[model samples]
Target: MGFLQPNLPQLDLESWRRGTRNERMRPLVAHLCEVGFGTPDVVYLFYVVKIGLYLLGAMAFAVATAGVDGLFSVGDWWSEPIVFQKLVLWTMLFEVLGLGCGFGPLNLRFLPPLGSFLYWLRPGTIRLPPSPALVPGTGGRMQGTVRGPVDVVLYAALLGTLLVALLADGTRSSGDLPGAAGLLPVWLVALPLVLLGVIGLRDKTVFLAARSEVYAAIAVTFLFSGVDMVVGAKLVMLVIWWGAAVSKLNGHFPFVVQAMMSNSPVWRWRRLKHRFHRSFPDDLRPSGLSRALAHGGTAVELSVPLVLVVSSGGWVTAVAATVMIAFHLNIISSIPMGVPLEWNVFMILAILVLFVDKAAYGVGDLSGEGVLVLAVPIGSAVLVVLGNLYPERISFLPGMRYYAGNWDTTVWCFTPSGLDKFDAGTVKAAMLPHQQLERIYGEAEAEVPLFTGYAFRAMHTHGRAHFALVPRACGESHDDDYLVLDGELVAGVVLGWNFGDGHLHDERLVAALQERCGFEPGELRVIVLDAQPIHRPTQSYRLVDAATGELERGTVLVADMVVRQPWDTDLPITVTPAPQVEC
Candidate 1:
């Protein structure tokens, strides 16, 4: 009956679903479309194009330098002139002229107009020209303007001409005859162009134009010099290689060849074994049997080039090779990471070869012999080491101390062993005995006053008590334990007793008071609280009176009172209650 009683009408489910059909379907479709593919690959492709261009430029230069005729030359190619070489020679000449005259004045004439065009084209890349300002004058103000296109072009032209001139000169002097002839005309044209460029660099508007030109010339000259040095060094190396080969076939003793061969690994190892065995450490066996396999490999690598240098009979080539080897060795030694000790050994070996060649053969004149002579100190050092290991019974005069007078005169004094004669009487007086009278009196006294105090009123009302009288109990307490007198803190005066061998003094407490409490030594107030019994078996305290408002030794006690101990245990007596008692 209950289940049937609450029956209600059911609504249609299809009506509610139909009302929101578009809204539910829209978001589901949007999320499915949003998930995209991989990232863009344009950046990697751009870098590849840039690198290819740079490589292409370098290849072009190399091909231009090495003539096409040389590249294609066969066995009997001595007679023909190279067309490509001639073309390159002419091209360089035109480049020199263009730099000196065309670019030089042209740069000045078009710089402003060109810059304005470029700024418009690439608005974000270029900066606008600055506005001119007026300078105050007695008569009127004068306006200053920036350097225009003409001035800038003239400066660039001068720099270009200088570079061309330097390159031409280097090629003529250092290159082969054909190459020299090719570059000579360009060099000649550059000289006149340089002069013309300088003349064209006129800046009538600027007051400091002359100074600017001078600085520019100096800077360009230095830049040219650096370029020349690099080119010259390369040329020299090439020439030396050619000369060494020629000298070897001629059957002459090439000193350069010998030096190079000596620097080579194989020759160095062979000689190091034969001649430098005793000089190097014994662990590095010269006999080859005890040596590592790597040493033999290094020897083989060095030997081949060295043999060529020696056979070549070019002494200069040999020396250059040796220098190269030394440089390489130095580089190895200077590496920031890995195998530093091994590299150091290599450097030392190279140096040893140089020294031996200079010493034994005197190959480069008597200069080598002079170096060997100066190396006597090295031998002496070895001898000093040997001397230390072995003992010798030897004696020398004892060192003496002398006193000098005002006029640079020396006065001799007796040695330390003769001190007995100098102060014999003072020594005897110190040794003279005295009876223990104080101890005897202390024991004989019917009553020993254990408590003694000494105090001093401040010298100047605000100033310190000039002196302090210390009590024996003061040293036993901590630094914070102190006796205050007349409302002023006083802890500077204390017993000089040192626990654990008299090392701990009251100086630390005094210093603490001066620094932390802002009390100078002259501002100190002291009260000596002596804990001794007063006319009884019980412990008592006393406060001593000051003499001339200063607390010092022998100041008499002013007040005495016996106080019962709170506890019978061996605890330190309280000096706190002692200060409270009126004197």
Candidate 2:
């Protein structure tokens, strides 16, 4: 890949278009092993620039604290408890602003380059309520998904409260060292907590975008006192690491490592990228090397944190901290798809302060607040366990499975009429992926990036099964009649922000879209795949048409998907048979 231009694949689009769906995927998936997405180095540099700004902004927020100094002198106040607390809040604020996770070309957001504040602060964009029938104000005969003036105000209020807290001076409650700045004011900490929860009741999209899972938990930690507060935050971080590690213990993760490593600019060697797959260009299943890296990383995630958290400070703590710092830095270098660069940077800083600087504040230092001591970890543990056991009911984020390949995901197939209706009928911040791609890469050459995205999805285990099932979703013309797109991209367009969570674009979002755009039977067809239950070998799936509702439901064996090539989509189906479609 060049500095400014992408390395387009050498293929005849006219002839490639004439092949079968499986046939069409052959060369594109092959191109992935050699060229990956062929993304230019400039795009990755763009994300690096954003990361620098995030850190620069964090420094600005930290120095705003009265006692926190060392704007240029790193050693003076870098270890301050209040500084760590402020940066945590800063990361959350950055994410919720829609500038963090799913921003820029990598996430396919071009014209506006972001979705959160642009859509959330506006009054008429779509919103997804956590519940409809039960939450009193969330649903009505006509106002279930519309983001009215009230929604806008609540979103604005949440941002305002967080800013206020970030700017507030730290106070020394019963929870500080002799000369140390205290934690954030308890009321300030609790206000955004309440607002996020309240706003979540109205729109889960905002709640998840703000990353209520990690940030809100840390916010709650600020409400505790002294050792209790520090201990609470440590437990929250531990759960995040452990939960993500545990969730990766599946047949799916190697596939994730394969695709992510391929797209990464750091791994510029094409042969090295090819090795992640079973055989370069032909077989795209995770190779043995990919499996080894995936497993080794999982072990580090699972074990190193225990040492970091329990080691009462010494050379042992130093070693563990180094390992974790390296772990996060590698992820940062990868510049993975969602571009969660700032979150990883925050983790590295967090490792320095929480584990190294404050290493002595482990469990042994808790200030006899036994109730809070038990509650935070216990609450976090339950979410992780339940998220794995029943993924459909809970989002993967709250379930603590962010980086794991296992996530509730979807594929949307839009008819030409369906695409037009969607483009015209919805109030969205970004244009459709095809429209944006056409403008950026030109209409003739857009297919490379488009199918590269498909190859990226197909590299995942669910992508294997999801594609195999697409012929069923489209009923007849897999080529002539449908334009297949990733549901996450669609969610970004219509819902404003989606961080690779399928729950954002599942049946709930489909129903909302039908309500707004009113598609005919086959105009908008979707394949909804839930993450595999931890104890179950099979994953459940649903096929829904925007107008007709659920037409089929079934389970695909995880074993079947893990063994296939990226372009290989044939698989046996069980439970519901043929889709209910009219010729």
lDDT against the true structure, each candidate:
0.23, 0.85
Best lDDT among the predictions, by candidate number: 2
Each prediction's TM-score versus the true structure: 0.18, 0.97
TM-score of 2: 0.97
Q: Estimate the TM-score for candidate 1.
A: 0.18
Write the residue-wise lDDT of candidate 1 on 1-583 in tens digits.
0221211112243442243222222222121112100111232232234334433332343234323223334222221122212222233322222211111111111121112112112212111111222221111111211223543454455445544433332233312222212223434444534543342223211111111121122222222222231222222222222222221221111211221222222332444433322222221111222122223323433343333323323564455446545544542322211112222232233222222222122212223223333222233233322322220100000000000000000001112222222223111101100112123224322011100001011101010111112222223331223322221111101111101100011222223222333432223333322211112222222222211122232212211110101111122333323235668
Off by over 4 Å in 2: 174-179, 577-583
Per-residue lDDT of model 2, residues 483-552, tens digit only:
9999999999888887899999999888888888899999999999989999999999999999998988
Model 2 residue 524 CA deviation in Å: 1.0
Question: What residue runs in model 1 are displaced by over 4 Å at the alpha carbon?
Answer: 1-41, 44-48, 58-145, 155-583
Index of the highest-TM-score prediction: 2
Q: Once all C-alphas are superposed, what RMSD does model 1 give against the true structure?
A: 39.2
> Candidate 2's C-alpha lDDT?
0.85
